[model samples]
Target: MNTPPGLHLKIAEWMPENGEVVSAYDIAENFGITIRQSRAFLTILEKDNAIETRRGKVMPITCHNSHRRSTRTIKVISIDRDIIAQRRHHYNTYRHCPLKSINGLSRAEKWEFIIRNARRRKK
Candidate 1:
């Protein structure tokens, strides 16, 4: 059988800027992997010190500037400490808003937000 899907690239892509934090669901959808797959990948990455996840408030460095003005603070996984540090510097300069957890939001809800907001800008 073929080798299993490698999540290294996905993990790299999922890493947020210095001050951002992403949820497990975010990584799954972003990498087009299953939720379980994302979790498994994250477990491995955490061990490798490729990414960091923590309880409570992970800030978002980037945001959607649409009318809805919805923001997300996602946890990030980065290979280079400098990159994350630079992003943190940028955040200091730009002042990105810190992300807050929304109670009662399921994985599906988060996906809907991404899709809906993405579509809204296409028009």
Candidate 2:
């Protein structure tokens, strides 16, 4: 399947590795893609280490194989302090940060940036 550009990143950022049980139908309905595409996306998520196994299952979905069934709602993962800090450290910027510009900045560099900004703000 020809995957869309940056689709994997979007999926990873949206879905937690060990959180939530989303149905394939839900994924398809929300992403406006087909069931086959949704299944493929799940595989891609796994490869990228995006989704983690929960109870020995990556994502246990209901009525995944049945398209005729009502689409299940997406489960929202409860964000804790660790996850928030992780997102901040890894992302190094806003969630929808364009080009992930700040991610590559080192800790020292980030400190310097903060100091520089603080100095500027003091003026």
- Each prediction's whole-model lDDT (CA): 0.55, 0.56
Q: After superposition, how far is residue 114 of candidate 2 from its true place, in Å?
A: 59
lDDT tens digits, residue span 1-123, model 2: 466876745655565652566665557777788887886766655544334422223443455555454433343333344654575477744556454366789999988877875844455
Misplaced by over 4 Å in model 2 are 1-3, 17-19, 49-123
Error of 1 at 24 (Å): 1.2
TM-score of 2: 0.39
Global Cα lDDT for candidate 2: 0.56
Q: Between which residue pairs do clashes occur in model 1?
A: 15-77, 16-76, 20-74, 21-74, 21-75, 22-74, 22-75
Best by lDDT: 2
Q: How many residue pairs clash in each candidate?
A: 7, 1
- Give the per-residue lDDT digits (tens) of candidate 1, residues 1-123: 222544554575547443556555677676677755665665666554535544335434344543333323335434666755565567566666677565678999888876875844454
